[model samples]
Target: MEFSQKIDVNILRRTTFSPRVKNARIHVICGPMFSGKTTSLIKAVKSHQKDGKKVFVFKPKLDNRYADEAVVSHDKNEVQAYAVEKSVEILDYYLNADVVAVDEVQFFDDRIIDVIEKIANDGKSVVVSGLDMDYLGRPFGSIPQLLTIADEVTKLNSVCTFCSGRARFSHRISEDNGIVVLGEKDKYVPLCRSCYNELKDK
Candidate 1:
């Protein structure tokens, strides 16, 4: 005769609220490709850590440009991140965390707006970084809307590949007309408005 395994079904529900987490505020960091958006976001997270705040970093599951468990910068700095397929999932992870950061905000759907807003109102810091425009020079989905709700907005600049000027646009050279595309250094180049217009004119 074989014995069946018995499982414990009694567990206590969590109901305590954390006092360390304060009022939530949304921070948006946006720019074109190579504009150091991710770097700036990581810096903010590190600064929060230095202040003795409990911090959590997250990225969209669609962004596989870097490792799934960490957000890596061009300068090789690394920060552990939780990868979720949907922005709504972030709320579940914030239960006990003091600060919540979301990278690649552009990839998330419209629902992210309400989620980010609600989280911020609950007394936690929400930091988001993403490309403001797609390869077609159009606003990349929820990024523009998120900017409106953010408490602070920081726009970064990258070096234009053609003229070494301040790059403000991400020029898409690939055939993909869709807003979302995964690419490397060979796929897109940074350009200033003038240079970008010139390139499009050709």
Candidate 2:
């Protein structure tokens, strides 16, 4: 009667899926509008280029403020890039590239978080630049999560349009009430805490 419960422990063995781990490098540059986030990303990727590493630059298809397939800065600096609608599209072109750079990353879906993590886990350096917060001063899209997981984070600042002080927020000029409206100096302005609170409260 005591031997009735005897069973093989080997039957409980289960295969587990584990992604290969490497010294993945993820660098995120984020800030309010006019903060030179894109410019800093361009500089980082260019440095990688100087080191003889193959680079692939990409941007979300929604952003076309300057060029349809490029990352442009407020000062008119630009870099050619691939425009993709989905985060999964990046895998199609990044396999052979040593450095994968993404601009305007906040415009992409949450899938982007996994895509960049996978890219870096594959031993390629991943650099992303985007708005850390939306016009409403909330954490934007996947950028906040990316900032948390990144190996390095750069938070830049611009002068406030209201007080000429260090601006930490991107204020929306139009009352569109939409979270993803794309515009330049005409639709958005950088603001410091005082000005942002003052304007936002009103």
Best of the candidates, TM-score = 2
lDDT of 2 by residue, 1-202 (tens): 3566766666656655565545558999999999999889999988989999899999999888788877887777777799999999999999989889999899998999999988998989899999989998999999878988999999999999989999999999987888989887889999999999999856
Q: Which stretches of candidate 2 lie over 4 Å from their true place?
A: 1-23
Across 1-202, the per-residue lDDT of candidate 1 in tens digits comes to 9886854444323445575546567999999998899999999999999999888998889877769899887777878999998888988888777788888889887889998887777778899999998876889989878988889999999999999999989998777767777776777899999899999645
Q: Which stretches of candidate 1 lie over 4 Å from their true place?
A: 1-23
**CA displacement after TM-score superposition, residue 160 of candidate 2 (Å):** 1.0
Worst 10 residues of 1 by lDDT: 7-16
- Show the colliding residue pairs in model 2: none
- Model 2's lDDT to the true fold? 0.90
TM-score of 1: 0.86
